[model samples]
Target chain A: MTDQATADLWPGERTEAARRLLLAAVESFARRGYHATTTRDIATGAGMSPAALYIHYPSKAALLSEISRTGHRATLDLVEGAEAASGEPVEQMRRLVEEFTAWHARGHTVGRIVNNELHALPEDAFAEVAELRIRIEDTVRRIIEKGVARGEFEVPDSRTAARAVTSLGIDVARWYTDRSTESPEELGRRYGVLVLRMLGSAAA
Target chain B: MTDQATADLWPGERTEAARRLLLAAVESFARRGYHATTTRDIATGAGMSPAALYIHYPSKAALLSEISRTGHRATLDLVEGAEAASGEPVEQMRRLVEEFTAWHARGHTVGRIVNNELHALPEDAFAEVAELRIRIEDTVRRIIEKGVARGEFEVPDSRTAARAVTSLGIDVARWYTDRSTESPEELGRRYGVLVLRMLGSAAA
Candidate 1:
């Protein structure tokens, strides 16, 4: 089953049917990757006939588009929420790294689908997702810019630092697993300090 | 067409027939990805029949395995060569980041196929590639460790910092483009500084 935070992002869609179908698609896309996974495979994984899948998603690309759009919205919300929280720049960054890294690590299956399956979305959907991604990057970049202006951070370039910090967190989806000893929270804590240090902030 | 560095990596096999097939595989796999590409497509791209593809590669998976293995070895060699060059730890780190990032950016098509298509590799081959990957990580980690030990770098965690640094470069493959106006050399120079700062080294 998916975690509470990830599930909560899709509120009002908890009808049992949609949940099973979406969850099945996420797992299949994560395991076999988006290109290799078929709609029939997703339907079978969800214990449904192949014909039943179309009633919900219309097509495999539609399923991917929906997932990507939802994931991007959730990510944008998470980053923006962290950015808007009441705090000094340092505190804001720590919270941002913690939430971003933990989200990628804890909900890694969906994270993989969201991050790695972008190419699978139809052209129209990809444009929308790209705009959302730009907003997400801008949010992080603004935080870093504020930190530099406040003299709370001293990176050579705020934009590049933002990109590196984000890349550090997004990569958790590629490598994190339950078998690892580090919990999502623990990884978040570690990365928060590491990333802050990268920005020339002293460790907390 | 692939870049000169990528082409030169596969020297001694530059016979006309082999070059066309291999280059076509790299481009197709990079564009459409491995699972989505059929041998037929690759053959057509190379100006050969589908059956003719078998004369060079036993199967489509074999083609992927060859590309993945060759790419991994090439990457491993590149990173190791950078690390082993004579310099202080900080300078070594700079070279490593510059070369590594430039390679990923310049050869991003092959880089995508090599880094993103790992799951398409067969089990035994994956194990070998995995070992090479470990060595590559170790090479970077050891440089950071030496830097920390010698007081040349002051990272809270060498292993985590190395992972972050590598993740930063690997991500260029996902996002870099010639149309972006940031040349590979410029990107490499910028990243080299960011990574050194991450390691607590002063700018090179």
Candidate 2:
């Protein structure tokens, strides 16, 4: 596994073994998808036995839930962090788009599973992740709302505009490849400028 | 299956049984993903035997290839059709975004599979679909180029702009649900306006 992959696992995961299992699950899920990946596959990828896998994660679903929850929380924290960093609405949005888009590009494998594989999550786990998703959306909407209030941006519908911005960032995971010449930071800067134009900010 | 679902199948599929199998594959791939779904599951969904399914599609990969090829072709046609119908660049872009985004929203199940499941296709089939994807991107890029040439749009990088626009539309499939209060047409219109602003269009 690449050091980047190892670093992307939930930093709060206390045990090295559990972090290894989570990284293994992400690789298997990203390669074969959540439904196709088996507990044995994850264990094999991690160089552990299925029985040993149970010590870290009770089931495949639990592993997925933990990944989903951690990924969503990271995204939420990124957006909120960007929001808190800037007093200006345009700068806040730029930071939000830049960091958020870069996060997706950098951790695209985890982002793909977090955004796409939640359907496989158990009900309560799914709900927990859904709540985080809502917060992310609402946070973006609130940013746009503040922009409109300050007359720094013009949008007829804050909700849809927020969705479009978030969608642009989220879909980076769908298509980003290491073969691409652009770095994640470059892609993030490009998207940040485009998003300003998208929001009708004069600063664009 | 719903009438809309049946109608979305490749109309050129000559036999009724072939269309049934194709539709079943789309539904199965969308719900369980391409990797987890089996030919047996597809045949069962279509009310046919596995042996009977082979009479039409040679393999599950074949079914997925046909779906991906057909869906990509339709998108190409849609983008080209919009381009053909408009002489003005701004109008051309509006129509492109509206139709393209609405198509993804309406056929989200097939859209999801066509966009996300192509990784499961055999190498030759994946190459074939990749060619179509490149054409779609090129066509959109050409439209933006025309807009830039006429000074109807101002974008520092047309290629990335095209990518962001297409990304916005394609992602509708990931998040769109019947539960959404916005209809596909309305969502498309909303995106149409947002895309104009994104492109730095004076018409916006």
Candidate 3:
């Protein structure tokens, strides 16, 4: 992976060793799930000793919390950044869905870990992740609400619409495979059009 | 919790003891995930010895394969039954989405186990489960195709639209909570309408 992709996958982990451990944890967790993966497995995947793993992360759950928090924060940033781009609601929604879908597809391992491994998080960590999730949903809802207000979209319920939009993007992580014909960008474009149709947008 | 619900969750597991074991496996796998869950945990959940659990399920993977197979079959039966119902394309699509979404919500635990834990299944088991999933997707696709043929819907790509419909429903298993305001049926109804809108139906 490129440095930029690495940073995108696990943002703000500046230390190379720490980032390597985090990446290893993501792969192990994605393949075997959080509860099934051991510190030894993670350490081995990162080419480090178990003690070295602890030097970076205090416990397995700590590693999970860090990954969950960083992944959620990255996605939240992506959505907010997409929304901040100046455009009509339709264009903004299109861009938001496209970018969000591509990100999930491209970083599916981290996406799956962040999404499917939430149950393994410590209570406080789970709550922190939940807060990021709500903010992300609200950002999508806000965009849909704006579209409805401007008469560009016909949505019965912005909250439900937001959930559907996010669901469409999030589900990509669960199903996307390397053998799949569509690239992340291609899938994003298709979803962008499909989501527009879903919202009853004239632009669809 | 009802007998009917039990049968629906794990169809064809006739013996009461086996059904109990299956139910126990579902709970353990859903809570801790497949790889994390031991057969001993499943047996304990079912109030039996590990030896007795083995008599019914050869291994933990066997239990998961059964759950995965049964869940996929149940959903495939649901989509096909929905299609076999007498209705216009719009109503058929509505019923299909409604029932599929409600099934996932009501049986969220089994749904999660089936959809999320496929990797834990043995190779042949995974392929078997994949076949059932494809049938389910194809059933939805055929319904959408019929709607387009009958001039009842305006979907650009039936395959992608079918995927979106199933994705919307499958995701409910991941996110639905008892604390949520909407009941399974209510969420299903909401999704039914949203799907129609997604297809660009006049009824939407």
Candidate 4:
């Protein structure tokens, strides 16, 4: 579970058994929240005992921190992934929103835990997560900047527009799912319209 | 306080004192969040013993419900106040964003508690707050609709843009004031520009 490669992303053992344990932590954290969940519960959710679970991850907080770190990294990566696309700023934003919204819907627990118990982390840990978040924000701002230079979009302040786009996607963690009134694909399509128009995109 | 008169937004008296008590609840809930805060801390923060606090508001959950209700009502009132002004949709949007941003910045704990612990409310209480929120959202949507009808703005979906505006303002609560880097008015003005642009206002 602690493999730094995926350890930072939260898949245990690379083996099936530890992967089950890691997945269990997601369910436990989602339902009970980070502060309320326990190693024992995660173990039981994986059909094991607390002591056995400890062999995979040192403690409950450790498991949470790893999962949260992984989730945050994934979000940053998703936005960065959009940079490879060659298109107008509006098209880039549409792609970013698609990846951003879908990840939160699929990786529900990690996103929820990171957002909810951010205060639980030690100051240094909090700074790490905060830095990761800022990088993502800056990336969005750069995209807006690129769009402005291309005359593909216009914003009063690229920074504030970036924040709006980021918040629009992040808020999905608070409300999104298959059972939700709006499906992930539908949300992506609608958000594409919303975000594109926010940048003065007539075609979007 | 407890005064519901539209003219007397902030009552002064024991009932007005209830507003203070409720504000205390907002601070407690925002700091520790809804699931983590105890009613005792709320009472003590209000300068009353926990037992005395209970006499005014039955439980932590009840306190959360009241603050959320009041917060939503205050938001609706602000929008209504701006709607009464005779102006183009762009002007109306600017004023609404200015006031809404100030309100969110002024009472961040109220915003945080409302957005974060919304699920903690009892069914009936949740329904009440939810209805109030929907009403506020609908009010914003109406402005968008009117603007679209007047050909003053063009949005793919008025409802989606309304949701974007709310999300943008509410985010002020999550990360506002915590950083001493920007004044409330400055943040409000910057966000106002962003929101107006998001609403498809060329003036933004």
Candidate 5:
């Protein structure tokens, strides 16, 4: 909407330059927030002209689209890859919670932007992001279903339980920070215990 | 910073007008998010001039600060009022979960905005808001500790159990909507059952 939208600012940059631009945008977006972060701010943060941002992406929306897409993909891979953790369904669930929560706590910018600002994305992009989320959610549902069948867990409404687990992990993106006393590993382990109890299983 | 810094905005003429402005701000902040929402957007949504909005509030920050303070106060009141809902500690805990979840579902805009944007406020405002939150959290913690002491329930750690209970209820604001098949009351009751089970008690 502004003159020469951020999308058109840069074409392609040096690999390091693009990486810096991405990191700068991440910090700015996390610090001030998405809609408030201008291409100029991100470009300046990367020590480039606003016009240079276009070398890597087409628009500010493009920047957000990429971050969200990438973050969701990473999250989905963790859940789907839980299937490959080489453990019982319950242990797989534990590993899933640990990996998921830690990623969110460390990947604050991208994860929070993805989870909190879904309503901000343009239509086609939102659909892509939502589909990725559904896959991750379905992963939780399947894990719970398997646990129930194996008699490792007892719970009512696996779908709701799945929702609870996913929601708990997602909220870490909203609130958890390194400034807190609890380390990511410790916090995730504690959350895993509560999550397992919620599912009516043995201690995590 | 704007000339609209008058006390008239607090709660004067045409109470519905102020109410409408407040509600519209909530929607704008939730839909577009706190950082993205501007006075112009909110004023436009309420069919008022930007100057008219000033007559109602000093600045955009004031609007958000007021909303957050009121929302936190409302939450504190809810928790304190629900402290003695039934004869038994377990029943009281169930009522707390049911009420809190239902409150989050019904008041998603306020809860979401307060939870997500509290950091945007200045230090004094932030401290005030944090105090209210700690109070509510302690109330939940005390309730669980008391329940354990009374032998109505058992928990691994009363503090951890409190966090799980609050997190489950708080998550309702992020996910539960009227669009879902389960009504707020239904979700509240179902979540209450899980909370009881996690506390080592039978479902109420």
Candidate 6:
């Protein structure tokens, strides 16, 4: 229940019941979307009555907001961790794309909800989620800026390049499936090079 | 009440009432998403009673299906039209990216519903919409294949490269705003160059 990978993917602690609820919410939200998914649906999916959901979460919006905040923080942490892992900008970009793309492909259920369902969150929740998003953007931008500063990468605009690179992974959640011909690791490898090339990396 | 651009953006001829309902549906779906938006909301948005909506479209799902089909067809036409406008593979890629990106930015409301709200579509309706999506993929893949053949582009995998290039524009619908400093044309121009860079075009 507490594997290293699962522990790393989700940022905060949760009880077994709370974990079940969040997992149910991810499936329902990814399947039916935030606006359409009800707490009853999430509760039933988790094998509990509708009333049981409110004991752990205030509303359906609370469930979605928690998921959004957790996913965003995890994403930001992945990239920021990559930035500190090495001083080489090229390696940093490669690891960043690989981990990010794989996360989106393998955890598409969470990825889909995190990226596509933002508008459904309440205003305050959205702001909290958005702050993490901006930090993710800034972290990617800093990686590009570092490469540019070292004359290692050639991008027209670091900010736009960062956006495109981020979009590359986010869109993977939209199309990737269990039956996809390319495995998550394979996609991560291909995208790693493709993104480096987009950065105008001569090495790519 | 129909403008030339609106007529061009939406395929087929629609009655004024039908057009009103569709336009209203786009606004509602783009704002609240399909599952959250009711037929009454669409009807009210169009200044018609709920019953009046049924006269034009059979159900809420029907309105969404129409919008999804129209938008997917419109997108396919834009890309195919670009392919025919030039014989040069590089030029073909450039125009394809420019027009496709601009359409997503300028026509984002429709684009958002078409891409994001597919699950709300019934199975048969989703199948029809998906066929157009596959064709859009093929069209982009063909552009890359032609460029690779003509020595105008360098890509590791044409299919994956097509997905990335297409994703570059599709994600624009998710983030573009009236407050965005870059206009549709500007985003299109920047994206065209970035896509060319992904293709490894010497010019880029």
TM-score of 2: 0.97
User: For each prediction, how big is the interface RMSD?
Assistant: 1.7, 0.7, 1.1, 2.2, 1.6, 1.1
lDDT tens digits by residue: candidate 2, A1-204: 332633665677468889889889988988889999999999999899999999989999999998888889889999999999989889999999999988888888888888898788999999999999999999999999999999999986999999999999999989987676778889999999999998999898
> Per-residue lDDT tens digits of candidate 3, residues B89-109?
888899999999988888877
Per-model CA lDDT versus the true structure:
0.81, 0.88, 0.85, 0.73, 0.76, 0.84
Candidate 6 on B1-204: residue-level lDDT in tens?
Answer: 222333465445788899889888887887787888999999999999999999999999998888888888888999999999999888988999999998888876677778888878988899999999999989899989998998888888998899988988998877776667777887888888888887888877
Better by lDDT, candidate 6 or 2? 2
lDDT of 4 by residue, B1-204 (tens): 221221133456347557667767766666666665787888887888887886788788777776667678888889877777756777778788888887777666566667777777899889988898888888788888888888777777787678778777877776655454666677778777777666666677
Better of 2 and 4 by lDDT: 2
Model 4: pairs clashing at backbone N, Cα or C within 3 Å: A1-A13
- The number of clashing residue pairs in each candidate reads 0, 0, 0, 1, 10, 0
- Measured by lDDT, the strongest candidate is 2
Winning model by TM-score: 2
Please write out the lDDT profile of model 4 over residues A140-190, one tens digit for every residue. 888889988988888777877787788777777675544667666676777
TM-score of each predicted structure versus truth: 0.93, 0.97, 0.95, 0.86, 0.89, 0.94
- DockQ comparison, 3 vs 4, better candidate: 3
Q: Is candidate 2 or candidate 6 better by DockQ?
A: 2
Query: Once model 1 is optimally superposed onto the true structure by TM-score, how far is the C-alpha of residue B91 displaced, in angstroms?
Result: 1.0
lDDT of 2: 0.88
- Ordered by TM-score, highest first, the candidates read 2, 3, 6, 1, 5, 4
Error of 3 at A47 (Å): 0.8
Query: Clashing residue pairs, candidate 2?
Result: none
Please provide, for model 1 over B64-113, each residue's C-alpha lDDT reduced to its tens digit, 9 standing for 90 to 100: 77777888898888888887796678878899899999988888778777
Q: What is the interface RMSD of candidate 2, in Å?
A: 0.7
| Candidate 2 ranges beyond 4 A from true positions | A1-6, B1-6
Encode model 5's per-residue lDDT on A108-148: one tens digit a residue: 55666677778768888899999998999998989999999
Per-prediction fnat: 0.51, 0.89, 0.62, 0.45, 0.43, 0.49
Question: Between candidates 2 and 3, which one is better according to TM-score?
Answer: 2
